[model samples]
Target: MLTEDFIGRVVIVLVVTVLTTFGAIHLFVTFQQETSASSLAVVTRTGTIAFMVLQLVMTVWRLPPKGTARGIESRVTSVAGTFLILVAAFLIPAVDSETVQVTALCLIFVGTVSSFFCLYWLGRSFSIMATARKLVTSGPYSIVRHPLYVCEAIFVSGVIISHFSALMVALGVLQFLLQYRRAKNEEAILRQTFPEYHAYERTTPMLIPSLSSLDWR
Candidate 1:
């Protein structure tokens, strides 16, 4: 007898695994074609590939949710916030500015590296939807309650910059709003599961890191 939760986990793992494999193949083909690519391009591709692999592993082994946001709104916002940039990328035409491309690459690299650390700290607590597995209040979470979202925003900003257009700008704004809503949904679940989360929330910034919180030592 297979429960819905087990089936859902299996599906999620399979989907992510497939996507990561395909993305790696695409990157490999691109690298082969552009043998003279810059060092940043090479480093970004490597980091991106590593991130995908780590995500796939984490998806397979993540802890079961202690609480999940109920209602269609939570589900819709989570899914939309996660994939909006990919949708925009597929629809928009990328710009041809060398300088902007370089900047975008730098941003993507930083976002990828930052996200990897966030995910590392998150460990088995990671999920695409608003669910509470464990309260992670250390590391990057100490700086911002939703460090993952901040890193994602950085990544998405780079993607939008590469595909700079009026429509993409609009979509980027929408994406940020959706991510905010998604974070709130996650916070609701976390607070419900852990009473101490309220204290953490009071002390920590939501998306933006507070300058005053830094020790600077």
Candidate 2:
């Protein structure tokens, strides 16, 4: 016998799953609707859908209660980030997908795959806003304090470059700033919750990993 709250959670999860699946299907179908498709288009679109499915999977697993908000910063960042991502994706012209498209595809492929690495290690710990779930300090996390954000940056750089929109570039810049603040807010929570986070922070680079940041132990 499940409680109402538990049932509600299940409903929410179902709804999210449906939404993600529908969105992926919609995008894939749209790709086919195009007059012609290039390998680059196929690869990037497939990668985007793969990323979305992964997100849905992770969302279901991490359906547990999240921590209370630290402030409005994370909330704003979360909304803005989501909006920017969708806008960038749809704003991509349907045709004339040449120019830096190949390079963009490569960047997106790398970023999408790297994001999977970060998410796999993070497991059910993934969260959009700055809330302490479980601290992931191994795998990609060991490389950078915010490996997911790094991956996202790689992914979005491709979108902006391939499109080469002044507006998209501006959106990317804003997203990066929001993500930086979001990372800091998450860190504050983690540091307060887990004393060992300081040691982790000292060893790990905030965004990029290098010899100095590697915890080779």
Task: Return the top candidate by lDDT.
Answer: 1
**Which candidate tops TM-score?**
1
State model 2's lDDT: 0.69
Could you tell me the TM-score of candidate 2? 0.80
Model 1 Cα lDDT, one tens digit per residue, 1-217: 9854566577766755665566565555545543333333444445545555665677778898888888889988987887666555544645556666678777877888789889989999998778889999888888888888889788878777766899999999999999999998999999999999989889888877788544321
User: Worst ten-residue run, lDDT, model 1?
Assistant: 34-43
Write down the lDDT that model 1 would get.
Answer: 0.75
Q: What lDDT does the true structure give each of the candidates?
A: 0.75, 0.69
The 10 consecutive residues of candidate 2 with the worst lDDT sum are 3-12
lDDT of 2 by residue, 62-124 (tens): 735345355566667765764465456654553345546677788888998889888888888
Quote the lDDT for 109 in model 2.
87
